[model samples]
Target: MGQNISFNGTTGVNNDTERRIHIPLYFRILSVIEIPVMILTLVALCAVIKSQRSAPVFVIHLILSDFIQIICKLMITSEWIREVDAIFPILPDAFDYSLIAGLYFMACVAFERYLLVSHPIWYKSHHSLKVSCVVSVIVWFVPLIFTFSKYFDSLSVPIGCLIPYPIIILCFVGTRRGLSHAISLTSLKRKLILGRLFLVLLTYTFLIFPIVIMWFFSQIFPQFMFSSFSDVLYFFSHLMFLNPIADCLLYLFMRPDAGDLMKSVCCCCRTDTHQNSTHSRDEHSRDSRATFACCVSVQNPASHSQTACSSV
Candidate 1:
């Protein structure tokens, strides 16, 4: 997932020296933060999708990709289990590729949202869970091409950076146009949805573009590959992992059913409180009525007697 700054000399002779320089503290901190964030993001995504069974298929696929990515990142950071890499030779590539796949999957999600809003009937007729599943599989496949190819492995990250520019731009533009033409939704709701999309796009670009630009230059300017510069690059590179966390927050803020999703996630806690409040209110009303009835009977005894005499 990152260039090991701790390693010195050639790959073969570097293992023993690795113990001299542990992974950077900042990298460790990012990895630790990511572990819990990834777990919570996975939980939130699953909860959201499960309760809202009609959620877009792309959402499900996106979460699945993130789940895989989190696992890979976890492995990458597992310093104690260095032997795992030996057992799983593809871990590093898998980690990088999974992260790259996420970018593509997100692009697909934007495209899906555009279609759903812009051309609902056509999207509905053509869309299937199976198609989403297939697309998810395809997104992971591209990375494996570079994973196994020796010549391409070195250039994979830079190429990944370059490859998705057009897709991302096209999807961004299409999403904007779709929102503009969305006649089915009210102005306020459409504006909110468009705003959400814009935030997601902006956050993604901000996080990803810096690393891409750095890598682009590192290819041409070997000085950009110095350890000091590499350290900075590593920091930004791992920051990409924060995208899933941002994404979950975006859903919480933007989705119309966010409150319902929260209640669903915390339904176990809400049920008792709701029931207790309703029961307490009912009991209070019943007691008040009983007290009122007793007071009325006492105060109206003379009237009751007159009514009895009239009846006789």
Candidate 2:
């Protein structure tokens, strides 16, 4: 997306020449970090797909989109594939397609949660796996169409990204308000739903929005934004890689057993305290049982009954 700005004119050409040595180094360093993360994301994707239990449809698509993104990004940044870019100039821009798809899926997830909480009857009756599948197909194609169309310029790209911003925000706010009145959801479920929405909003704002805003400005002030602030623009562009990693973590956080996983971690950290408390509880139970047995065996049963009732 920031490719145009990074290599636009004579000034950009000069800057590129100056940083020719450093750019490959930077990309290598990025690949080092991104490769492992990509592997981990792949492992997670396999696990999610193979499980017999059903996962939220949007979540699976979201992870798939992330995996595609990581692969595209690695190809785009790899120095060895510089030859491929020469033949297919559009190759470096491949990640944007998946990126936009991921954002749409993220919005879908937020909207689903919003409906689940805000309108339970409608969500329960109308929301189904088929509906989710159709929506996923549409989300994938919308970005594909945009990518092929001549109208999808720098300005349009930012506008497209901006389209989901308000949708996400509205869903988050609506869900928050709905939680107060939601009686069907348990307290833990409510918190997890709200948390997922919050994380989606947070990641989109901090990770994706900066590049979107940069693209918007680059369109409005081409020379100034690109030539004068090329380094800053480059930094904002690479900041996008973090989004896929965030998605992987979000997948883990959104798991049904995530709460149990957290509790187990907490227990592991407090083993000594728990053991001491358990021992004390066992001793108290034994003392109570012994007192009850002594009361039952007493000869003066009426007096002992009153005493046992008080002690027990």
- Indicate which candidate wins on lDDT: 2
- Model 2 regions lying over 4 Å from their true place: 1-3, 6-54, 84-87, 150-153, 226-228, 265-312
lDDT tens digits, residues 1-312, model 2? 444552111123135554666555655576677667757766674576456233477877887887776666555545577567463366534666777788899899899889988888888888776788898999988886555542445455566677899999999999999998887777767777888899999989988898778767777876675344667666676676677667666676656577787677778879978899999999999999999888767757888778889999
Tell me each candidate's TM-score: 0.66, 0.74
List clashing residue pairs in candidate 2. none
Instruction: Give all candidates' CA lDDT scores.
Output: 0.61, 0.71
TM-score of 2: 0.74
Worst 10 residues of 2 by lDDT: 6-15
Q: After superposition, how far is residue 300 of candidate 2 from its true place, in Å?
A: 47
- Model 1 off-target regions past 4 Å? 1-33, 50-53, 83-85, 253-256, 259-312
